[model samples]
Target: MGRTILLKMLLFFGIVFAFCTCGKRPVADLPTFHVDVKQRDSASCFFSGYSYVMLETNMECLLTDVDKIKVDSEKIAVLDRERILFYEHDTGRFIGKIDRLGKGHNEYLSIDDFIVRDSLVYVLSAMQHAILVYDVYGHPIKEIQLDAFYKHFDFWDEHRVFLSSDFGNDTYYNFVLFDLRTGTVLRRFDEFSQNESVFFNSFSSFSGRNNKELYVIHPFDYTIYTLTDTVFVPYCRFDFNTEETFDMGKSFAELSDQTRNKSVVKYLGNLIESDSVMYLTFDLFDSHGIGTYLYKRCGQQSYLIRINEDFISDFPYLSSPKGIHGNTLISVLSASTILDIEETYGLSFFRKKGLNKEDNHVIFFHKLE
Candidate 1:
């Protein structure tokens, strides 16, 4: 009996170990999730099941805007105006908050972005040129000073980070691989050659999925790249081949604001990935409106499903997904937007969820088909 019990315990631990390492593959070891740019407006698979996480709206956790969100297995961290709020991911229960939003050395004036790793949170303050680290429960750890111009960053590994700079100006290198512990840059890329005519993107999104996977898009270049432990490699390329794509023979000097707005498909980012599928959003010219697509990872073209929400589609209303959990694509929409849809289409989503228009936003977990 003792030998039989010992064998069973070893088997149980082996299963647990396999579950933990399943999603932790070094990125280069993983197969590529393929997508074609011309299929931007193609037919999509109908995603069937979803759930709403109504963020607990109390006096301490009233959210004005959800600028950014990071989710792990248990906790969800949201970056609001000046504070980073925490919530229970499965139940949407409000927990504590990190509100060191003052001028003191320990506090940050603003939160440009935030990254959550293990139980630690790294809040980036662009204006202050520093990153304040804290525990998940709002306790201060330490602050890491930054080199003044990194607009956005995501952890490439435990000791290294991938940093991005502003577009348009001929100032800093477009991207850098920096050593956080050694205070050194190991590599620099895309040094701007043009000095005069400027083109810039106001925001840069360094999309990270569970710290094991990191992806970024070039400001004007239509290629999306993935970062492994050592290098950034091309993951997918967009060739819209339409008149609206910016690089189709248009010179930088001849473009105006109106033309730039119409060419959004050219400057696409917000690239979110999961283990089985990849998702992103892009705008079409004029009345074409916004779009979301779920490109399956197995290299079959037919698996691409355009996540469309007409007034009566069974799928819940969705925008760009902020992150991914397991195989589900996670997105958040304001309760107000749902109230508007309710008001216009005579739907009862808000009423069913016990949500008021002014309540906190709702998070959607879309389990892909």
Candidate 2:
């Protein structure tokens, strides 16, 4: 009887061990879809015959063109509209604008960065050389003076703001963290050097995903940097020296000798998050021309989407291709003339058709496939 009991106990323990060793099955990953929106109008607020708009819930607002006016949602606020506008979801009003107080175009208002809360909007105005806080109704609430031209401002949390500036040279640009509630500078970093002369003509901080990081891009080098409390680190850098399979146009070469070397890193764009993946559009230019490259960041790998020039040349005057709030891709395309390339597949044929308004002017959104 004892021996039989012992054998049964050993068998039960062995079965339990086997079950514990078998771990949970790994979750399957899904394939990412690529979507593009083609704009119908060729001339708008966006510099390259394009416009910037955002879709939220059931409403959309067109920021660039004055003609195609859409209903602005109450949930999103139109913060600023000097050259490039910014919208915040929480405030539901324009946060920053050019101070029209006794100023002309010579003293135009330029907002490089902003942070909005329930009651006030904190703005870093580059041309103004100060931080301006405004109420929801575009009224000035307060101001913080600074010695440098503040280029970009980001929020670390509800109370802290990060600011970046250029000192009229490539190497002197600095980043500072300010306490918004107290109007005090908490930290600053001035050791980093920027290659503004070679690659980036200008730099601005993109909206960060979390409070821990701030992302900035240099257009000329196609490089991106991230700043934290401790240091300014290089995050992702794209070198545009790759062999080109096709050429759209020599847009970069058309700039004057002084501006020819500069490249655009960030225009008005956004980061789209789906499932566990993040999608970002890096608007870049090379000797070939201006184009948008889609990048995907998975758990460990970061790579560019396998899109060809044929896909780009098919739509001339295409501005920033932005991701919608939903799972769609939207962009504004403008041209002196719009063309119909829906039937064309090759790059050479699409360029030959040129711009024909009947085919080109429209805002395009494609469901990611």
Candidate 3:
């Protein structure tokens, strides 16, 4: 009886050890949940509007087109044309711009995307085909030259950078996992879809809540993946419930100017999720408008925020709610749109800031309730 009990204990221990050492499961093995989004023309306000500060502009900080926006511990970093426009954390006072547009070793010609990590700014320059790092106070730190041209990228960790390339000689993977320390290709996954439209629509392609957890969504693929320790596990699959979802992987480059304009109506954009809420947007297939959707996880409820009623009337016109920062849902309103809003609504917020409606922009931050 003692020998039989000993054998059973060893078998149980072995089974437990095997499961613990398995690491990340395959995408096929992980379960995928479907978020039910109710289609609507308008809904109630999800977040309450708090105070907002316009970005101050000067010779060194002349704001042009904002490519991306990130909120750090001490400042707000805005990726303008070829430089990073920094603003004070608590107040929207302009600090300075990092780097510049030049052919020099440290300067970048074209800034594609940027992120703040460990109090350092990593800027990706597609023209230069390199990423330059700068300290918070506008000092050069390091630079890494990529193997190929990439349009957008975000830091996977301190050592690895996840890059998205639309054009390359090889057509195997959609994203390249790059090592920053050695400047070599670590790994690549996400098979490329032979469609040109996927390249043009690639913006806000990668996002995450933290270093350990990051997610990427391909517009042509329409599936979300969570990068685990070992594998890219399938997280959420969206069901548009129609055959016409996403132009059927059609390349927008092949379409005529009229067809391209018509196709923008219903193109799917990015999918961003927080601890409880998920946000996604799509253009109208029939009309010239953009619709934003929100899915509440606790109640499994969905809402299509009315742009005119909930957002535009109170705040200026927004491109889209990009991501959640701290306890707020953040969005960008361009200077041109803010000027139009001021003229149409007779608002004095722009006047009080002494900002030219065509030069500088304002960020709308609403506290999540």
- Indicate which candidate wins on lDDT: 1
- Tens digits of per-residue lDDT, candidate 2, 108-223, equal 36655555566565666666777777764556677777656666666677777777654333336567777767777778765544323222322344533433566654333333
Candidate 1 least-lDDT 10 residues: 194-203
Tens-digit per-residue lDDT, 44-161, candidate 1: 3525578878899788898876776778878988877778899998899998899988898688888877888988898877777777889877899988876655667878778888
lDDT of 2 at 115: 54
The runs of at least 3 residues in candidate 2 whose Cα sits more than 4 Å from the true structure, single-residue gaps closed, are 1-108, 167-173, 193-203, 218-223, 236-278, 286-288, 297-319, 322-369
Which residue pairs collide, candidate 1? 44-305, 44-306, 45-305
Candidate 3 lDDT over residue span 136-223, tens digit each: 6678998898887777787776688788775332545657789888999888766764535334432455644444666766544556
Ranked candidates (lDDT, high to low): 1, 3, 2
Error of 2 at 187 (Å): 0.9
Q: Measured by TM-score, how close is model 1 to the native structure? A: 0.73
TM of each candidate vs. truth: 0.73, 0.52, 0.75
What are the lDDT scores of the predictions, listed in order? 0.66, 0.46, 0.63
Evaluated against the true structure, the overall lDDT of model 2 is: 0.46
Q: What is every candidate's alpha-carbon RMSD to the true fold?
A: 12.2, 14.5, 5.9
